[model samples]
Target: MLSGERLSAIRAKVNRAQCSQNKKSATLSSVSINGDRITERKKESFKTANSFIIRGKIEENETLTKRGERSLNCAQQRYVVVVNGKAHTVFTHRCRSRHCQNCQRIKAFVWQEKMKEIIPELSINFKNGKYLFITFTVKNPKITNLRLVLKCMSRAYAKMFQRKAFRFVVGGIRSTEITRGKSGDDEAHPHFHAIICLKTTYFKKENYLSADEWGRHWGECLEAEFKKEGLEYNAADYPKGFPRVDIRVAKSADGKQEITNKNIAEHGDQLINYVLKYSIKGSDLLKDGKADKWFWEFDKQVKGIRMIAPVGVVKKMLADLERDQFDYYKEQEKIEKLIADDVNFKADKAVFKKEDDFDYYMESKKDRFQYIIEAIEAKAYNYQCYYKALLSDHLLAFRSGIDGIIENFKKIKNTKTREGFEILEKAEMGLVKIQCERIERLQFICDALVRVGLYKKMSDFEYVNIHTKDKTTIAKNNIVGVMKAVEEKLLNDFNQDFMRLENAKSQDVFNTVVDRVNEKSALIKLVRNEILAAGAYAYDADNCEYIDLETNERLEVIATIE
Candidate 1:
């Protein structure tokens, strides 16, 4: 009887186990192949761009169904690129991170594709096309004055390109690139790289002002514009400091720089490519963004109206306006209206007087040659270079103490270098050697002189005769004159024309003599018929100062009034 009960219990247990297996099998059979809804729901970030979408190659963002599952067919995709120059290939990839630099290549390619539609319509076939890449850079310690610098640059460039003088079609198509430079500040100081398309067939980018007759045209246009605004566009009086301003024009491809003082920006397709290099797809300085933080703040009142922008940005903007010639705010109001209207307007936009355009606005009034007489005055010594070209190619030689060549004057007759104050005892140039002839003429007076040395006083000076050698060589005598030539050159080279020679004992030494003549501190004292050294003096029509380059002396001699 006991054995029979055990057998019945075991039978009941087997039947329950069989029922559980049947239920589990049913559940497994009901499972759907598209099991993971999360994977299938992933959003695809791509537009159906113009090109053949090789179906197998593109990531369609579809379901994988299971691990390690891929599409039944998969291959690589190809794209054809026809630009102004040549055709190329484009491959697409995932931009894993927004900060990734590699992604820019694909982004640029896509932009090119979009631009193709536009370039075909806007561009006219020019015989030769060139692109000029113009960049507006700010000075170092950018955090302190970055915004003001940028504002000035923006005004200057926008005015330069958009003004009636520049006359490009709607400010030309512009692309913007912003970089922080190597300084590595949190501000990532902003600068702009502009690609200017200059239609060479119609609009020549580079015009030779020094050699060709183009300089007069360039100067006239600039002068009229500056005069209208009461702006001082004197090259001699442009501001001096770091973040030095410069503009370069060269062929769109590898070529020599354009030295001509004209609007030499290249135009057309080649220009487009060069411009695109800087006008790429990223910027640290954006007015608004959906991905990162950007602030529009407001402080203080403008005519009882509130203002807004990032505190630092607005602070800089206001400070920049303050730095201008007090008309900054009124001009800013004009720009505000333009900005509201979304049209390009600049300070150089045929504006009015008592308030010069931006170039003058940027240029502080306290420059060296603000005085009209000073503009034409012969320099004592070279502080930098005499007659620096503010617009065109003014050659400069920057050694410990050398300045570049001023136009037509390969060598200053007797003017000295401000840096070393070493008189040009000799000079050698292409097909022209001036100091040699001067050295020959100086031989006539060498017997009267004691010896030649650097910044040494010639003691016991007696009146002596010197000779000058032009096409006709003739000897001449000189009594009292000043070191005008030497002083001016020194000032031009070093921007310190009057470097006084001091006696350890006498403070009056400063008034008595200076190694350099043209320094702003250098006083020009006029005596009698003979001009004195280190004193404020001037010459009349005939009885004037004669610069003896050989001895580096300035002499005043009697002359018949012409």
Candidate 2:
């Protein structure tokens, strides 16, 4: 069956087919190798960034500790989230620190989503109106004066709006942003970004303010505030007495007369994202091999500052929308809890490699052990550097010890007074201090939540009169008992003073009794008002329940109004 020429041709064809298959296999192998390298590089980059963040946090914590201030620590206490494959997906944590890059990214995403929902409403409401993006800036200030500069900037913006010409502004959003200055300038540059809603009348030639006029008005306001604050002003430093102020009319994609809903949404999204960017860049904190002075000072200055605020109609609408959303989320959570037993959902466990294990795993086989040892040394060295830096601050060291001593003294006083007549007086004083601190901390948390539009403000809560029904339980009964105890204490103090006044032993005794009654009444009333204001409810004798005015679920009442 084999002809010589035909057999040779067939052999050639077979050889060609084999060669082609081999080539494809080689190509695939190469591609697989390249992909592995890319993934490795990505993992390395993530680890490096994570390490930097951890180091920065440690340094910040050290500084704060030295100054006897509250700082974000507890690196291990992170909210871990796993996504995708067991080995394929990179594990991460929700650090939730203000200066964390990962947390900031998540925050930005949340902000974008919220803005996306709200922007369409804004477009519909102000269909006939025009939009403008205005940026108000001030000269970069030294780290020491950053807080004051920020205060001045805020006051100036408020003052500018108070002017007769700015009466046309209906609704707008304001965000305070700070960035590190580069080259030949002080580091902290504070500015304001405002998404201004303008009436149609503002588009007219007569009413329109050019960029130059905006700069001038901004400068005047800034300068006046600066003078009032007694801050040094140099005409040469800022020839215009203010940093650059930019104003641009927002336009549609096609540059047409009528702006579309899509255009408004996109524009609003961009402005909000820009405004909501991290107050301080993480990179600025730990640059190169050392932490910058600016980072430490900036952290101290920005404590308790409200970085974002909405004004006018936008504020009211946003508040109402947020409240509704919060309620919806709460209801959804309740439903999920109810159905949790029936739902067969499997959650993927996040696998976080320990720092040492990660380092060892990432190393090449040839020098793995050596690399691990070096990595350990490097980490130890970094900690030493942080410790050294903290020690260098003499003032912080002195201040830190003072707080410790005071705390120890308080503890000692408590133990020593256990067997003495003065025990009640000391205990009462300590209780007062503890109560004050608790109130302050609560207020701080509430303020932060309100600032971020996560929770309703006190005034808004009062307006809504939102209340939660209480259930019958031992815990609930105990809460009721505490409330009664508090009430009884107040009544007993009042009754004792009244008896003393009735006796009228002497003029001095009568006056003292009267003063004591007035003081006790004022204190009791103040405490009751504060509890009610914070959304705690009084016990209802008829219902045999203590309803909660703050939250939807039944919770133990720590305090209540009369």
Instruction: Return the TM-score for each candidate structure.
Output: 0.25, 0.48
* Superposition error at 155 for model 2 (Å): 1.2
| Full-model lDDT, candidate 1 | 0.29
Best by lDDT: 2
Per-residue lDDT value at 129 in model 2: 65
Off by over 4 Å in 1: 1-103, 113-130, 141-156, 168-171, 183-189, 199-271, 278-562
Query: Which residue window of length 10 is worst by lDDT in model 2?
Result: 80-89
- Against the reference, the lDDT scores of all candidates come to 0.29, 0.50
RMSD in Å for candidate 1, one decimal? 34.8
